[model samples]
Target: GEYEVLGEIGRGAMGVVYRARPVGTNLVVALKRVEASGLEGTEAVRRFREEVENASGLRHPHIVPIYHVGEQDGRPFYTMALIGGGSLEQKLGQYQADPRAAVTLLAKVARAVHYAHQRRLLHRDLKPGNILLDEAGEPQVADFGLATKLDPGGAAAGGPMAGSLPWMAPEAVRRDATLTTAVDVWALGVILYELLTGRRPFGGKDRSEMRTGILQAELIPPRVVNPRVSRDLDAICRRCLESDPDKRYESASALALDLERWLRDEPVRARNTGRLERLVKWTRRRPATASGLTFLALLLVAGIVAAVTMANEQDARLRQEVCRGNEFAARHVASTVLAQLQHFGEAVEGTAASTKLTEACDGGDWPAVEELLKARLLDTPPGPGAPPFATAFVLDPEGIIRAECPQRHRVVGGDFRDRDYFRGARARADRPEGERVHLSRVFTSKNDGLDKLAVSVPFRLKSGGPVWVLGATVPTDATLGVGGLHDKARKAFSVLLAPRESDGEEYVILVHPGYESREPSVPFPAGRLRPTETGFAADDDYADPVAARHPDYRGRWLAGFAPVPGTDLVVLVQQPYDEAVAPYRAFFRKFLEWLVAAAVVGALLVAGLWLSRSGHGARV
Candidate 1:
């Protein structure tokens, strides 16, 4: 509260950093807001607090010290000592021309990083901008925002990707291994190289190109770019930029030691590889040799490419036929089941509403309505494969349970005014006279612990505005089994009944063979019936990967949906992308293996031919 408002110093995804001064004190400080107000959450706040604690614990002269950590308006904020001198990024051109000063600055930053590592703190992001100079022109490490602790056993971090993309290590970019302190070491190498050459080692115009360069581009030696660079300094810079973390300096301390040696004109530990090591490293280091091998491999497989192309065409044709057949079957099945349920409900509504029972229902006289229902309506059979109707009931305008058929449970006087079906039917009362029976969203019964939906119709007193809702609770499986939609033929596909959530715009799984509520499951049961991508909000992004594939499967998928007439629900059908691409992927994998074998054979033949010719020349 004592700090006065000041200009913003930096802004990032997490929050903003500002340069502020205390009301009565001469000292200035940097204020970091953990996250903006709109982004507040329990998890986000917890992570913010944890990061602040991690940064506050470091006590090195080159490391910035946190003065205070506090929260305002549900957002956490921390303050640290403000460095007066500009960041290392601002001094790149100045340092690039002075080799001694560049190495000296890098050595100080490296020593600070090593100090943090000793405390198990890994500063995942180590670009030049994060290193700032104090008032006396001394380097001080700042911004531990992306920092994480290193594993004692040195296992890689399995967390989300950290750090700027251009300076990221290959392992961090690929996300194939756990992150370790080695990532920071790799970033420092990049910083040192950038400072020495006035540009990034793997420079590109955009992030995608930068990522490709980092993963595949070879290092351009500093001495070649700037001839004034000494061999010792060049070797030190290259050692830090080694693509493999293991090949780079083992620790920040070791990098500092080498930089110090280069400054003092002493022989550095880093050097060019011997002949045998160079021969082994030739394929990796020499892009030309690798490119030639790749060219020969492609030539050797040219003949087989035609065969693979034909196989792919055949695969596409087969997939199209399969999809057409599956859709026809699912549509026929879904329509059949929905028709039967509507027909049954329509019959009951016709007979009961026309009789004197209307008066009893309108008056909320449940006992009278029960008698009228038994005397008039015939009991629907527990069909050969169908689930028995769980509930046949009527609700008054106030949504109280007035009558229950089959009267198994004493629910005649209970309240159902808060139920989804009653609410849905009432909402439709303003619609044209023709459309009114509203099917509720599927939900778990609070009492019975089962998933079910209510098909409800609103009726009036042959007259007035008071609406009575006739409801029936039907199990989801009953709708799915309408025409054998989940039969043996559909083993490769998934067909489900989905409904929009009443409380939100997101879609929720109502019924499917893969659903836990779907008993006597299907052949290829999905791991999760609930879709991470299913929703129908106004501004939903259709291209989102989650919305593009079935949660149970990976890769692209083919999905189609048909609305259930008279209701805001749909029959959703989904099948694996592999169903269409499996044949292609399979054929290609085998073809690739064969091609690789041919390429290796061609390489050996060329090597033998070269050796034989050289021996003959030597003999001459």
Candidate 2:
């Protein structure tokens, strides 16, 4: 380095820039010394010489002209004009305050870049530090440290990797983009953005992030950061920073014209830009925002899946619970109804008056039959809380009501052939002695006008000479007494008792909570009401019951069965689907609300953490 070093003017990762003079010449110069020992070997020396030649190739008033190049003591040094006004980096505060003046300076710098492009020179490292201002305050594009010669045919400029990472055009960084004047134009755009906004477009915390930002990050327009920057300048800056090299200005000369237009208050060449183009530039400049949005979108999707799965699982669990509760309830109801039937059957057998009553009715002694019915049949009170019997009548073999005991209303000669109770007793007339009484299939009683069950037994005047049927009708609802079991706090349920056979072979409604709540006064029309199933008494163990559909309710109900002992009767407890699954719906709704709140909080926490960590390492 054959120069008298005056003082350190600046220092960078490469080496130190100093104010110096040649051994023989008294001319003041800015000297950059490439310490080969640190740079290591022939490649560093070659690159050092290239930097000098690249600057010397083109001569222009606004371009820092290289005056000398040489090597001494294993070191390489180059000399250019001593820009007393310092780098554009230091002048940013002053120029950013007056955007018009800043644009004027950048326009001149752009022309200097165009001059180098004319000579097939590409100054790929164009940044604020690379641009200098002379004593007269005229901008001079400097630092050809990473410059390359554009191919004469405008093909790619392939050489050693070079350029300021943040300011380098994406194609130049890749070293595959065509080595054309557009590369210099892109660098000029970065310089102008820094000069006007007092900030760089890329704010990545590391070289890797910087490279990505340059390649794909959005550019924050000059006007956005600094309102003093006009829309024309904003558009001009974007045109140059285009990710596609082809989309950039054809040459630095073209960029200079657009910037000049802004200074002249005329519309810029980048006027064709639209919202989409601006948005792309903004996205590129803010990589963190894009990545954060992508991360939250994924979290949102995952949360939705989790909520749906949780709701389904909860629904399943609630249904199982409802089924278990209904199982216990069904057995309780079945036992109660069975007990009432057994009690009445025993009373009839123990009373000798019942046999006398049957004899009197068969002998056509109407007066004695009436007295025997009152003394033997109606005297056995149905006990406390038991469903009262509608009537006790003796049906002769011809199926006529002979005598009604303590009975009101009318004719003792009423025909009983069509009645369910009479038919049921007659059917079981030849039943074995052990299987004494017959339990009638459930039916709506025409007398009391409620759900009723007929339990009957047969007797002979003289050892099967002629059979007579003795029967009683009991209201099934009062006998079962299960309406209150349909607890709101628990779950909705229905209870049914269907005798083996007797009435149309259809198991009938005994105590349905759904029905009672719906039509308390209006009786279910007999034989018109459809049964949930047949052969309920044959079921041996708990199984999935058939779903019963009723238009009186919201949805279908699932039934669970329990058979009563020593009887052809099955008790069923049922529940609607919605009621069974209500708990699940409530739980999932709360969980979803909490999940959404947590997701939003998590997103904010991550974003804040990133900002806190990145504040110190922001690219200058």
Report the number of the highest-TM-score candidate: 1
TM-score to true structure, per model: 0.48, 0.43
Per-candidate Cα RMSD to the true structure, in Å, reads 15.1, 33.5
Point out where model 1 deviates above 4 Å. 1-295, 301-329, 347-384, 404-420, 423-436, 441-451, 460-466, 501-504, 516-557, 584-586, 593-620
Candidate 1, position 572, lDDT: 52
lDDT of 2 by residue, 3-57 (tens): 8998888776556788898879788888887754665466656777777777776
Give the range where candidate 1 is weakest over 10 consecutive residues by summed lDDT: 535-544
Cα lDDT computed for each candidate against the true fold: 0.70, 0.68
RMSD of 2: 33.5
Cα lDDT for residue 594, model 2? 84
Q: Model 1: per-residue lDDT, tens digit, 1-620? A: 86775889988767788999888988889988865656466666666676797799999999998999877776789899999897988888987889899899899999999999998888888888889998787999988877777778655464666788888988888875577677888898888888878988898889889889988999899888888888888888888878887888889999999999888877788975366676668877646555666678668667467757776687667556655554555455557657755764564455335547687865767777776555544255323344445566777888887788767565677887878888988886666654666778765554365566676677777666687777766654524435455544344443555443343344455556544433421222122223334221111111112332336544454454455555555555555555556667787779778877878887887667666867898999
**Minimal lDDT window, size 10, model 2:** 538-547
